[model samples]
Target chain A: MKLYLGVAKDIVVKRTIDRRDQKRVLGNLYDYDVVIKYEIENFKDQPVILDLAESMRALRSEIGVNNQRDVEWELVADSTLTDKLDEKKSTADQAVFHVSLPLRGKDDKAVKQTHTIHLRIKNEW
Target chain B: MKLNGILTLTLALLATMPTAAKNVDLSTIPPRDTVQLTIYNSEDLTLVRETRTVTFKKGVNPLQFSWANTLIDPSSVDLRFKTHAGELELLDTTFPHDKPQMLYWAVRSEMDGDAELEVTYFTSGISWSADYVCISDPAEELMSFDGFVRITNNSGEDYADAQVRMVVGTINLVEKVRELAQRGLVSRDEAKDYERSRRKAGAFKADAKNELLSKLRADFAMAENAARQPKKIVKEGLSEYFIFSVEGTETMKNGWSKRMRLFQGHNVPFRIQYRYRPQEYGEQLVRMFLLRNDTVSRLGSTPLPDGVVRLYRDNGRDGLSFSIEQQIKYVPIGQEIELNLGRDPEVIHEWVSIRSWRNAFWFRRHGASVYYAPGKGHRIKINDAVVGWDEHQAWVERIRNYRDKPIDLQIRRSFDGHVVFRSNLEPSLNDYRSPQLTAQVEAGEKKELRYELVFHQGHNQKQTNVTLESVN
Candidate 1:
């Protein structure tokens, strides 16, 4: 049994509407990290962030395993890998499309089931 | 002398040969050293001054042209030609108004074919135009751009002490706009620009500085009067949009009372750029205003310097957006640049006002008619005898599902002349902005009874005794 995945397709980070940068609230929700390269087996079980997925359930950050451990990852529900009905958004010449998960795997017969497939992708502007 | 006087002089020489071919150059006032480009001896023109445009084709042109010593004092000048490949190299006996002059050429070409061209110079009057005016309200985060640039120097050439800067981009980003449209320097070809960016004394620096309009003005005036206008601010780019306001999503800034006329420009020489999406706590305040007055005189070609204008911010609803690329600095040559820019102090309120009520029925501005008429039928009767309104703030609510709702009412009838009635008023009042609907009309003088209108008509016949509460 073997599997793996890697990604870093298109990356855009241009801004001009700021609300006091560094922010993070809990219950009322307000957490913004823009884009950084942390890793936790590439977002545990990927596919979250559908325009923030109805106010969010879970999608923590701070990853760095092989480069020497720096964990603090969290992902609640993995979404089989996006395209839950295709449709991209374009606003006044700017662009956006996001997704990312660095690896994948699936196996059955070790007495039954063993699956762990991850993913990652991003298209921003 | 007799063939009908030669057919009336051949129809007057065929209408004077098309009025002399449409009055070729008509009055002829352009000539200060007219006829400038003469590249006969010095072949291969590489770069001719006067800004640009002097390219030769054909294998080995190598030209160096100049006439009457070449301005500044070339014994005035005079030269002309329609087509010349004979390459004379130079010619201009003498002709000069002498104040404004520009004659240059540093020829160098490895020619290929049509290596011939001629130009007659003389400028005492040359002014062209396109001007400019872009006014979009998108509900006013504010953008009412304006334009106009006119400079006619007659070619006698008198540029005293010059300093002009007007290049907003496009056409490859503004190239001195074809030398201000060739000395005539007129603007308005819909903000002309195919690609142009010139810097001699240089005036363009933006790595990401800051300044759209520090202070610059030639003449500015807003609000033609829709009750004084100026309230149309509905923005939605809060990073995702929602700058200036967002409580439930700020929205007002509508039509400023609908007087709609603004966006004006005259004589020409203007610059107006506006953008708003502030109300930021972190960072997002883009502001710029320079309505010109020119400050010290020469008036409007280009002069407004004060400095500081940097724009670029993005938040695209958290994934984080940032791309600030706006620049405008040093604008005080003549003077006029207003600034209120973005605002992110949390903003108490950005703007909001939405009241809906347009044409209420029951008309009569000059009453006394029986059923509205000068012609007789179309049924009309508005005595307005029982006008009401004094003490009643009503609201008949109840409608989560009354089963039907599609009402239409444009009532006015004494007989059947203009009456419209569609059923389904069923929505009693689901939170009607706080109950405020009163109706009561009693002519006996209780006075404040409000209003009431009752009319009946039927063409159904047979047992026609229908009064189901007057059809709701």
Candidate 2:
């Protein structure tokens, strides 16, 4: 089983190539890049942060390996979004992210996974 | 050849008829021309009679009747071609083998035309009850009573422009109407029992009808001798039962209730009294409105069905105000009905004097010196063994009349145990059954009734046995 630390989604870019023998090179390819943009908050300790960063690097290497398009990733930790999530958790409210999944094609390229998490805290003290 | 063509045309017309030998479409039955409901309130039974016009063929006509999803008792269905009975003859009725809820009727008509058919059957879940409202005068001696009949229909059927009749009596129903309607759900033994009971009910119905017919004939003979008058309610006596036919037709929809005025009597004579029965009602002085159901008292033609009767008192205004509103029970015909109107706070009665005394003829326990005998040195031995003891109780009841007019206050004072009583106030009718005192008190008058009661203890106080001699 391949271990993944973050959600992977497809990013599609439609292009018209002007290369010499572009027609022979199959310009209208329906492939997509496996891009990952992950946000994590309130790590609680340094070990949790280190483990999450290491999982992210492992996820990047394993994803889009047997595919045509190249894979990319970006991680935003302890940002304003994470601070807002922490504030909502302290005030006993719900904090969640709304994410749409990517569509997959028959090409032996990008495979994606999506995950959603909801957090609620009863009291701050 | 033309005659054969005419015969072929007639055969084709008969074959093409849509309603022949098939499930009757409900829409083809046509609207009811007249409908009547005879509701027996004692049982959850209503006999419905409906008349509708149907077109029949020249020779044989098959008519289908279906009552699906309704609470109609299929066994009691009866149909008759009321009009054109001589021309339209009912041959036979057959229940289809496949459809459980439909029955077909074969009628032979001499000529093809429109004929009216009357269908009657018994259905459950329709009920009616009588209610009354009475307003008393200031003196509480006269009242105005209004009786209303409330009819409720929940038999899953709608009855429009139906003439309603209410029966008032005990109808002995062994099996419930709903059970009979769903007879297939019952066991075979239960169905046998139901059949026996249904036969009994049929016999009772026939007897009641015969009695009613004889009574009506007698009444008609009596009517010729007496003055003929218009009766608002067409009441008929069915031996042990009485039925009242309401005047106008009413539209009774499914799951709906409607109340109509049955009768109203003005200046009905009544009496207001106070009663106190400690053994029954506990320290409350219940006020009662008493009335007689007779012609002299303004109400007596039929036996009143068991229902609610409300009473109200006018608050000295001409036709404007009323107080002391209370609901009571139904008053049967020709009987004196007593309606309790709760407690009376105005004309109050309380214990003003209470005196209890021990009779000197019997000895009672009095402290430690009870066994001491004079000159006998504690060997207190009487010639005859002490039999029993007696206690006499006395009381003086005071009643203050606060009403502006004189009121006849009847008081009933009951005791918990047996007592021999005598009073200064003369009981209207003195008997061992129920002794009561009646007093006519003027306005703002305070009257007192003194009475004495002697309680007896039995003589068999001890059984003779051998005693140990001075063991202590």
Candidate 3:
């Protein structure tokens, strides 16, 4: 499996100095549109539905995603024509992740960040 | 019958007597044909030249000029004819022994027609100065500079539709022109000589004619430059002076001032410099904008007159700072113009005297003791005393850049005495004329520089020898 972290660069947007008023402001701070994806190859069996949920839960915790509405996960399209996966099936051949994270400081003010995401994959039997 | 004949004879004699001719009133002077006001920046001195056509009766006409309630220097007043130089002759100028603030010009005109006469005089309470406003971009590499000229007139005389010229240079005057105007007095000896000359020749021609002739020549030389341009200041260099003539004629009433825009520069390149000097500014770094006044820097067409500069930052918005009043410095063409814009919170400066010690000693002399002698009334014996000590002091200067971006901060140290020993940071500039030391500090960095100095006491030695012997 290969990990692809996309759009992790810093983005700056305008920030007001005073919280009550929007007229007075300083320089701008950028925003980040983060996209995290995992590419898996040569999988003989479908992954358990609980494994997919557990992996996402651990990934969210590792990345320290600020908002819950920012993360989006979906199954990769079924490329093999041998077996047709059910529409309601929870198992997926591959996984794709998308996130919209705002690097912010106190009072939800946009700020510059040098954050790093640490992901560890472990198999315990 | 005899009494009636005598009354008739008296009545006939009264009727035959001619009427006495009335003296000309000086108040009904004609309007000015052409007027030029040359204002000086260094002093409240303005030279006025006004030409008017006056009808003179061929004989000696005592033309009176009064400047009551005006700041006109009577001694500096001059009058001459622009046309009919040979036909019209000025005999002399005299002030009435009783009438104050009035002058009489005895002119002998060979022709009876009108002649264009020019009157030149120096007056007080008229001055002009230059000022500017500068706006800079975020990076501080580009700016817009606008220049203006402020003219103030309080000469007690209204100048209507007068051409104005601002002169930038020092004029050597034997007496303060303003004081002379206020005194309203002239040397009686000179007036006596003028009165005597009037009886002999048409006018006493001395300083008045020389001054008028020189001014006329200068005016003719500037006319070529002024005629080419209309509604704009014609700038030209005259020997060691610079003259700026305003484009259109403006009315200058007494106690009134007018501000006229001179020039403007857009997108002119500039540099932001941070300066620190402990003696000049205590523990603070001043921000200054440096720009070159040249064609390469988008300025350099003419020398910039000294003026006040108001700085602003255009960060897609407007921010106004206090205006900086600069001295009357002539920014020559292709020279750098530096405007200090107050202090900057981004750069911090710290200074301290780290260490000091005393090391040298010397001797001193005292008063003499007096004693009675056989021959002489008193004999004096000289006495001498000696004291020794050396004073030494060391200083450390540290400057830190708090801003995230890199900056080359300039630090100037003006030592009260010469530096005996120095360390840290090679001196970028050492000007002994001003006795200033200059260095630059890097951005987001703190630079520490130390210097040791020594002082000698109770010594008859040369001052420069102290720095040589104490090589810390």
Please tell me which predicted candidate would have the highest TM-score against the true structure.
3
Model 3's chain B yields a TM-score of 0.75
lDDT of 1 by residue, B421-472 (tens): 2123321121211111222212221111112212221221123121111124
Order of all candidates by TM-score, from best down to worst?
3, 2, 1
Give the per-residue lDDT of model 3 (tens digit) for B1-472: 1111111100011211121212333333556777778887676778788878777666666666667767776666777788888987777666665545666677776777778877887777888878888877776789898889999887777887888888877765545567766765544443443445333432333354346447645764566457346698778877667788888788887788999988879899987777776566565778877899998888876788877777777666566544456553779888899887668777777665544444332323344332222123332222323243344556666677777766666666554333344444445434531223355666678777666555444342234421222233
Task: Calculate DockQ per candidate and list them.
Answer: 0.01, 0.00, 0.01
Candidates by lDDT, descending order: 3, 2, 1
> Could you give the C-alpha RMSD of every candidate to the true structure, in order shown?
29.9, 33.3, 23.8
Better of 2 and 3 by TM-score: 3
Estimate how well candidate 1 is docked, as a DockQ score: 0.01
True-vs-predicted CA distance for residue B154, candidate 2, Å: 1.7
- Candidate 3 residue B71 Cα shift, in angstroms, is 1.3
Superposed Cα deviation of residue B385, candidate 1 (Å)? 16
TM-score of 3: 0.61
- Interface RMSD to the true structure, each candidate: 26.4, 53.2, 38.8
